[model samples]
Target: MTTARIYQRPKNAMQSGRARTDNWVLEFAPSEAKKADPLTGWAGSGDTRDQVRIGFPTQEAAVAYAEREGLAFTLFPAPERKLKLQAYADNFR
Candidate 1:
């Protein structure tokens, strides 16, 4: 049985723009723990499903797809957005 997680895309902290944050993403849970490469010291695993991510416009759509595929999934609702109102001059203080 494949397990997956459905959640909304988070806003990137590197940029102010919130584009594409409304979409939901489905990611497969890693089946096995990653092993370090002896030579390059890179972390990797044989489970490739973790590398795939599917995006949907709405949460319901994402859930539907998961159910249709018979995949067990956990849905995590997006956290509420809080805006901090600040003035340009407040930066000096």
Candidate 2:
């Protein structure tokens, strides 16, 4: 049986203003190990499913998709990050 991981999208500081973090993502764990390329020093796999990521508006939707696909899923809890709101002037203080 294949296992899938369902989790909430993380808030990225690089994409803070323009990014959407409300959605959840469903990702399938790679069934096979990746092979390393000696010459290029890169590792890759032919499994296209490894790169498949489906974004859902809610965690429930992500869970539903995993069930529909018959994939045993592990639900990763959403991480709570506390962000302190501060002004630019605070940095100078």
Candidate 3:
């Protein structure tokens, strides 16, 4: 089995107002029990070894690609958690 997630790169991560052409990235993570390299190049090392990716132009395109590829998809909201954490740390300082 594989899992997928989508994320809108934060403004700081983008070039201008336009989303990067490779904005949409599809990541496929294999079941942990398998403990093997993913078939696709998107796979990373360590705990996320069983992963693969496909890039797209837009969220819709990414969704369509995921559906066509018969892979599960998830959308990751912008990193509000990180910002919140930073704010909390600043308060303590």
Candidate 4:
């Protein structure tokens, strides 16, 4: 049986905008550990399912898809965002 992980997308550290972060993502867990190629030295795995990612508007939608596909899944809770409230003048202090 294939196992999957469902979680909300995290905000990118390099960007200030929250685009696409609101969607929940379903990703298949790697069946095998990645191995380094002897000649190219690039790390990769034969599990092509690792490259599949499906996005849903809501968490329930993501879970439903996994259940319908008979995939075992683990749902991860979204991380809480903490705002560092600071005034512009505080930067000078």
lDDT of each: 0.97, 0.87, 0.64, 0.96
lDDT of 1 by residue, 27-68 (tens): 999999999999999999999998999999999999999999
- By TM-score, who's the top model here? 4
Clashing pairs in 2: none
Model 4, C-alpha of 70: deviation from truth (Å): 0.9
Q: Which regions of candidate 3 are displaced past 4 Å? A: 11-22, 33-51, 78-93
Q: How would you encode candidate 2's per-residue C-alpha lDDT over 1-93 as one tens digit per residue?
A: 988899887778776562657888889999889999889989998877899888998999998888998999999988887889999999888
Query: Which is better, 1 or 2, measured by lDDT?
Result: 1
| Displacement of the residue 34 alpha carbon in candidate 4, Å | 1.5
Estimated TM-score for each candidate: 0.88, 0.79, 0.48, 0.89
Per-residue lDDT of 6-68 in model 4, one digit per residue for the tens? 999999999999999999999999999999999999999899999999999999999999999
**Residue 56: error of model 1 in Å?**
0.5
lDDT of 3 by residue, 1-93 (tens): 456787665555445553453376777665555334567646344656344566776888888987887878787654453333456568777
Task: Please give the distance, in angstroms, between residue 85's alpha carbon in candidate 1 and its true position after superposition.
Answer: 3.4
Off by over 4 Å in 2: 85-93
